[model samples]
Target: MGVHHHKIGGGKLLIAIVLNLILTVVQIVGGIISGSLALLSDALHNFSDVSALTISHVAHTLSSKKATVKETFGYKRAEIIAALFNASVLIAIGIYLIYESFVRFYDPQPVVSVWVVGLGMLGVIVNGGSIWLLEAEAKGNMNIRAAYLHLLGDTLTSVAVVAGGAAMYFWHIYWIDPLISIAIALYLIYASLSLVKESTGVLMEFVPEDLDVEEIAEAVAREPDIKNIHHLHIWRINDREVFLQAHLDFEQNLSLQEVTRRIEKIEKMLKHRFGISHAVLQPEFMRDDEKDLIKGES
Candidate 1:
C-alpha cells in the first residue's frame, strides 16, 4: 500500500514540474517585457517550485527502495528529508521576495502592456490546474502538499499581478506594482511558515496527532491481566509508520505463554484501532516491578 501511494505521488509531482516549468518560462518573458517586478518575482518563485518538485520526485523514488541489512528501516526517511528541504527552500524564497518587494516599494518601476498582464492571468490558470492535480495526493502526504500550497500561493499572486497591471494600464498608477509584490511576499511567508511547522513536527518524531498517549496508557491498563503499564513511548517513524514501546506488568501467577498471548493481543488491538504496526511490549512479573526493564532510568 505504501509503495502504491508513493507511485501516485511521484506521478503527480512529475506533472506539476512540467506545468510549473512551462508557466515559469512564460512568466519570466512576460515579466521582463512588461517591466513588472511583481511578475518577475512570481516567475522566480515558480522557478523555486520547479526545484521543490524535483526534490519531491527524487525522494519518492528513493523511499521505495527495499530495506537492506545495514538499514532496517529502508529509505522512508528520504521523504521526510525531502519535506524539510522543500520547507527550507520555501523560507528562502519567501525572504527573498519580501526583500525584493521592499526594494521595489522604495523605487517603483514602470509597467508595460496590459497584454503582458493578460499573460500573467494565464499563469494563474495554469497554477490552478497544477493545484487540482496534486490536491488529492497531498491529503495523504505532507511533502506533495507543501508543493501544492506553494503553487496555490503563486496562483493567487499571479492574479494580484494581473489586477495591478490592469490598474496601472488604465490609471497610470505605478505604485500598484510594488503593492502587488508586497502582497505576494506576505502570502509566501504565510504558506512557508505552515510548511516549516509541519516538516519540523515530523522530523522531531512527535507522536501522531490522532493518537493520545494518555488514552493509550489507559487502554493498556484496562487489560484483565495487567497490573500496571509504565515507561510507555509512542512515536512515528514516518507519517504512516508508528512505533510504540512499553513495559507491561502482569498479575502474579500468570504463565509466561499466557502473558505473551496477552501482549500479542494488545499489539493486535493497537494495530487495528490506532494504526500502530510496530509495537514492542516487555512483560514483567508483578514481583519484579521494582526492577526497571529499561536501564539508566531512576
Candidate 2:
C-alpha cells in the first residue's frame, strides 16, 4: 500500500514538473513581449517550482529504500535535506525579484497588456493544477509541502499579475506591474522561511516540536516499578518517524524478564500515543544520576 501511494505521488510530481516547464517557457516569452516585471517574476517562480519538484521526487524515491547495517536510518532524511535546499533557493529567487522589482518601479517602463493578461491567465491555470496534484501528499510530508507551497504562491501571484495586467490594459497603469512583482516576491519569501526553519530543525536534531515529555512520563508510570522517567530525549527520524530515549528510575531492582515486559508496554504506549518508532529506556534502581526530566539542551 505504501509503495503504491509513493508511486502515485512520484507520477503526480512528474506531471506537475512538465506543466510548470511549459508555463515557464510561455511566461518568459510573454514577459519579454509585454515588458512586464510581474510576468517575468511569475516565470522565475515557475522555474524554481520545476527545480523544487524535481528535488522532491528524487528525495521521495530515496526515502522509500530499505534500511541496512551500513545506514541504519536508511535515506529517510533525504526529503528534509531536499526541502531545506529547495526553500533556500526559493528565498534567493524572491530576493532577486525584489531587487528587480525596485529597479523596474523606478524606471516605469511601458507594458504590453494584451500579452500580459493572456499569459497571466495561463500561469494561474498551470500553477493551480500543479498545486492540486500535490495537495494530498503535502499534508504529512515536508518535502512535498515545500513544493506545494511554491505552487500555491505561484498561483496567487499569477492572479495578482492578471489583475495588474487588466488595469494596465484598461487604464495604462504601468507602475502596477512592478508593484505586483514586489508583492509576489514578498509572498514567496514569507511562505518559504517557515519551511526552511522546519527542515533545519529536523536536520539539527531538535526535539520534535509537538512532543510531550509529560505524556511519555505517564506511560512509563504505567509500570508500578517505575518511579519516574528522566533524562529524556525525543527527535524525529523523518516526518513519519520519531525516536525517544530516557532513563526509567525503578522503585527497586526487578527481574530481567519483568523489566522486559514493562519496557515493552511502555514502548507500545509511546508508539501509539506519540508515533514514536523506536525507544531506548535504561532501567535503574536508585542509581546516582541527574534525575531531571531533561539534563540541558539535547
Candidate 3:
C-alpha cells in the first residue's frame, strides 16, 4: 500500500510540476506585457510551488530507501526536512510579496490587457486540478498535505488576480493590484505557519493528536490478567509510522503466552483505532514490580 501510494503521489507531483512550469512562463510574460503586479506575484508564487514540489518528490523517493547500519530509521526524516524547507520558502515569499505590494500601492501601475486576465483564470483552473489530484494522498501524510495546501492557496490567489484584473479593466482601479498581492501574502503566511506547526510536532516525536494516553493506559489496565501499564511512551517516527513502548505487569499465574496474546491484542487494537503501525511491548511478571521499566529514574 505504501509503495502504491508513493508511485501515485510521485506521478501526481510530476504532472503538477510540468503544469506549473508552463504557467510560470505564461504569467511572467503576461505580467510584463500587462503591467499587472498581481500577475507577477502569482507567477513568483508558482515558482515557489515548483521548488516545493521538487523537494517533496526528492524526499519521497529518498524515504523509500532501505535503512542502513548508521541510519536505522532509514530516510523517513527526509520528508519532514522537505516540508520544513518548503514552509521556510513560503515565509520568505510571503514577506517579499508584502514588501512589493506596499511599493506598488504607493505608485499604482496601469493594467493593459483583459486577455491576460483570462489567462490568469486558466491558471486558477489548472491549480485547482492539481489540488484535487494531490488531495487523496494528503490524508495520511503531512508533507504531501503541505504541498497540497500550497497549491490550494495558489489556486485561490490566481482567482483573486483574475478578478482584480477584470475590475481594473472596467473601473481603472489600479490599486486593486496591490491589494490582491497583499491578500495573497497574508494567505501564504497563514498557510506556512500552519505547516511549520504540524511539521515541528512530527519532528519532536509527539504522540498522534487523536490518541489519549490515559485512555490507552486504562484500556490495558482493564485486561483480565493485567495489573498496570506504566512508562508508556507513544510517538510518531513520521506521519504514518507511530511507535509505542510500554511495560505491562501481569497477574500471578498468567502464562507468558497468555500475557503475550493480551499484549498482541492491544497492539492490534492500537493499530486499528489510532493508526499506530509500530509498537514495542515489554512484558513483566508480578514479581518484577519493583523494577523500573523506564531507566534513569532517581
The global C-alpha lDDT for each of the candidates, from Candidate 1 onward, is: 0.81, 0.89, 0.84
Clash count of each predicted structure: 0, 0, 0
Model 3 per-residue lDDT at 21: 87
Model 3, 1-298: lDDT tens digits are 7788788899999999888889888889888888888999889989888888988988888888889999999999888888888887888998999999999999998888495587789789889998989988878777787788779879988999888988988899999999999999998889889778778888887766888888877876787777777777888778878898988777766777887788889888878877778889888775555444343446
Between candidates 2 and 3, the TM-score winner: 2
Q: Rank by TM-score, highest first.
A: 2, 1, 3
Runs of candidate 1 exceeding 4 Å displacement: 287-298
Task: Show model 2 residue runs off by greater than 4 Å.
Answer: 296-298
TM-score of 2: 0.95
Rank by lDDT, highest first.
2, 3, 1
Comparing 2 with 3 on lDDT, the higher-scoring candidate is: 2
**lDDT for residue 276 in candidate 2, whole number 0-100:** 89
Q: Check candidate 3 and list the clashing pairs.
A: none
Q: Write the per-residue lDDT of candidate 1 for residues 1-298, one digit (tens) a residue.
A: 8779778888888998998999899889988888888888778878888988898889888888999999898988787777778777777777887787788888877789585578778878888888888888777777777788778888988888888888988898888887777777777777778667766777787677788887888788888888888777777766668899988887776887888889889999899888887999988775454434233457
